[model samples]
Target: MRTPLAAVGLVALGVCLMANPLFLPVAVGEPDPAYTHTVQPVGADAVAGLDSPAAEARNGSDLDAVVAYDDLDPAARAAFDRARDAPEGGFGVEDPDERVDSLAYPTDPRLGDGLLIVERDGERYELWTRTVERESDVVLVQRVLVQPIAFLAGFLAVVAGAAVALRGRLGGE
Candidate 1:
């Protein structure tokens, strides 16, 4: 009874996941706003171009530049590759080493993209950001969805497969 119920629940959950998947948070290639907004000398001028990106990059923050995802271990490198090969909207991949292991797919844009498991060496602490540098008006946004509709078909297959296996093992319902 429990097994059957669990299988049914999985199907329902998969359906919900298809319609309204989670909206993940992401950062892009840009300097920190606080640092960018800081008042600093521009070239030789104290106030000229002070509110520019050059000032932000010179704000003395190590994180001033976007993460170098390609320069990581083989495991991380694989994730970055899958992201690069992903479709226009991006795709997801299962990385056991990632923070969640399953939602480890990195979504990359046409220009460039990178991902870093900033915490615990896993993709869970995802700092989803783009590698391309665009104007402030441009925004790169992508979400992770692992074959939303296909999950439903897979769930059905599991349920049928389980029922058959259980029937053969138990000889009856």
Candidate 2:
């Protein structure tokens, strides 16, 4: 009886762990809301202006702009590479004057028709009129499902083994 109870307790603990795994809190740096909200463009043409040569000289280019990690695809990757190689974080926008030192990917991203937001080093940059080369729903779903099932299965197996051991020990008369 005690052995069975112990097994049940172990199983319950395992279930709880599966339900809510331990996670560390992420430290988000201070966001430059002024730049994220005010300076960024709100339309398609404004986005294109950033990509032109004249714009690039000013640290402006749609390609050099920041984007969310999730929204990134092949084209985005190529753009990122081009931007990374650019003189000043790709936008051609200079630091201090524009107050933007290096363009980077956002910690969180929201995407819409011809628009996306990139959060980097606690500031958000907006990009417009761009294209994505690929999308991966399957990969995203797989990432979501795998963790819980794996934990639950491992927990159940351990509980079953403990219960069997207890039964054998008690049965010895």
Candidate 3:
């Protein structure tokens, strides 16, 4: 009796994990409102300007410049990458006034078409930009773990259910 009940429970657990009916949170990404906002739609030319070296030189200080996505420092790049992976388009920024991580994926897709804002030490730098693409480690890791777990659970459930069903014939009720 107990064995059969346990088998059913295992099957239920396996199916639930596979289906993810509850929408359990996975390691998607974090959100930082400080670096996130809807931007005004601008022309592609405007975005190109943000990536120009002239924009950096015109900032009057190297500490503050409108940098392109490819030109972003390692830390800033990682943050934006995480934002791109977020389920709800979340962003991550350490400090708006000191780091480029302060940038966020535009809340609206249309807003991200061309312009982006950067701030460093109270100075706002409007930068032209385009899209950035990167794979998320969090997402990769989730798939790696879930797939195996689901397979193992399903196998065990079937075995257990069979054992319960055959217990009487096996003379081990």
Candidate maximizing TM-score: 3
Please list all clashing residue pairs in model 1, or write none if there are none: 93-105, 98-123, 99-123, 99-124
Better of 1 and 3 by lDDT: 3
- Tell me the TM-score of model 1: 0.24
**Candidate 2: where are CA atoms >4 Å away?**
22-98, 101-157, 160-162, 165-173
TM-score ranking from best candidate downward = 3, 2, 1
49-147: candidate 3 lDDT, tens digit per residue: 444576467574433434465666776555555544556444434354543444444433332333444443443334422233333666565567766
Name the lDDT value of residue 158 in candidate 2.
68
Per-residue lDDT tens digits for candidate 1, residues 1-104, read 66566656655655554444343223456632210001111233432232346647768342333334445566554544554445542343222233333222
Predicted candidate 2 versus true structure: per-residue lDDT over 14-84, tens digit per residue: 66655544431222343222222112533335443444465568664444445655556655545444554
Q: Please count the clashing residue pairs in each candidate, in the order shown.
A: 4, 7, 2
Candidate 2 colliding pairs, count:
7
| Best-matching candidate per lDDT | 3
CA lDDT for candidate 3: 0.49
Worst 10 residues of 1 by lDDT: 32-41
